[model samples]
Target: MASLRRVFATSILASVLSQVLTATAQPAFGVCYGMLGDNLPTPAAAIQLYKNHNIGTMQLYDPNPEALQALGNSGISVILGTKNEDLPNLASSVEAAKSWIDAHVLPYQGVNIKYIAVGDEVIPGESAQCVLPAMQNLQSAISGSSFSSVAMTTAVSGTVLGASYPPSSGAFTGDAKRALSGILQFLSNTHAPLLINVYPYFAYAADPSNIRLDYALFTAPGPVVRDGDLSYWNLLDAMVDAYYAAMERENFPNVGVVISESGWPSAGNGNFTTPQLALTYNRNFMKKIVAGTGTPKRPDSHLDGNIFAMFNEDLKSAGEEQNFGLFYPDGTPVYPIFS
Candidate 1:
């Protein structure tokens, strides 16, 4: 036992020194914490969940100081966002934006709030047009605040891209390009990753047979697809590399990519393993990303993902899939996912 312990310790140390060795061995995620359900656990309880589980990150749908207060003093980083409806408001009223920051974020200094996600999943609707100006205004708002190293980014729904198969032929829709160029330029300049709300479940639901279940679930797959010199074994990389390719088409290939929201619903009765599949997808995907990786094409880059939600919100639009919880409303994990 002592010899085994020594070997494991040495392996961890060597991995930190050699990037390639660590690329496949890193454990855990940086957390994707969301609270939108009526069956919801309180924010305070949720913060305790992070502490008990040794989590290090939280992705929020909006700037809720109650949640920040819940996480007070925890080193876990936060990524807060502006709602889609607030885009026009943010674009039109810089004062309102400032007021929001002062009220929502200013009171919570000496806390672990990390990133400000401005206008989440705003790239697909009529609000897409407002995204650019909203981003500019939010940047100004963040700059005006005392929060340092706190990044400002936007979330784009996967629908922004027109083609995503083969991973390399990815490109944004013609209309989406003109509408989003300004925001893209801003992100490129500011050095923020393109935060995307990716749902491979949608891809599988669109066609399950063509998409292998194991690949989506991150289980050991049949074989890697050798599309010429490029290779892929899972749906997550295919979905992400498409973004890389699309961004490359737009001449901003180096901009970072982050999975701002990605998870399986714990119990979607009518759909594919809504919650179970969600757990599987997140478990395998998070393990891989935290290990420091990208698609075979972008292997040097480490992938960063935030799981979709924290609670199985019964109040979230009355949809079954809205219950995308790693934990039940009472703070018990729905599944014993950890080894």
Candidate 2:
């Protein structure tokens, strides 16, 4: 009897130890390493930057040879973009789009080149008429190419969804529904992520009272607004759920939606939110994201989001928020996002 009791106690301790080790040994996470800054490090050095910091993935606005060669074999998946100017040309010629991919995308196959974004924020307006053509051309190019597994899609603005505040009320704008529905059909046919960019910062700025600061910052939630079993405990999930609803309305509800851009700016329009607060917002949220905390709606979905700009661009055209970087230009650590 004494021997059996001792054996049972040992088994219990071993099980407890196994659980603790499993929790501790979980991999850190991934992030988007953007190079929007003028004084940013060379692509080679930038590769080293994320490597040292333990970032796993990155997104490039364009598939620059410098960046591709640098990130090649670094084990980082690259998200390439189409410049707005190139849109008109790409739209006009499928051959040009194919050639562009051959030159820019083909070479990086085994090393990187995960997705080729058709263009950014195209919603078919007076300004966006030039973009959809590029999308059609790019899609054609991808279809003809051997690497269709490399996702061929575009990143759309969260604003495309008319009302995002309440997740259920989300839908595309009047005319946008037609354009967006087509885009969704393309995404559905081709297995690609939605790549939706959500900014809770805009929500907080627009109406601080109605929107909880903690919720917007993704800090900690109190008793949150519950809509049946579909409760939104915070802004991030709320924004994501809105995307889910939009996708559902299009009948491609199972389609993947990734957070293409989501982070807080340290300083901005009036600087009401403190630098520390900004750091807290980004650092904490990223930590949670990397820890595999999916939105309330999609618990099993990959929450591995790509945060905005890797380095803060000092010459960022305008406002301070436009800077939107994880690091300052001169290789100085703006804040310890992981620590």
Best lDDT among the predictions, by candidate number: 1
* Stretches of model 2 off by over 4 angstroms after superposition: 1-30, 33-35, 127-136, 139-146
lDDT of 2 by residue, 148-179 (tens): 66777778777688876568766777766766
Best by TM-score: 1
The C-alpha stretches of model 1 lying farther than 4 A from their native spots are 1-28, 274-276, 317-320
| Deviation of model 1 at 18, angstroms | 22
> Which pairs of residues collide in model 1?
37-313, 264-278, 265-274, 265-275, 266-275, 267-275
**Candidate 2: residue 58 lDDT (0-100):** 79
Range of the 10 consecutive residues with the lowest summed lDDT in candidate 2: 12-21
Cα misplacement distance, residue 124 of candidate 2 (Å): 4.4
Measured against the true structure, the TM-scores of the candidates, in listed sequence, are 0.87, 0.85
RMSD (CA, Å), each prediction? 6.1, 9.0
Tens digits of per-residue lDDT, candidate 1, 110-225, equal 67766688777667677888777776766677684578567777888877899988788889998778777887888889898888878877777778878877777766445455
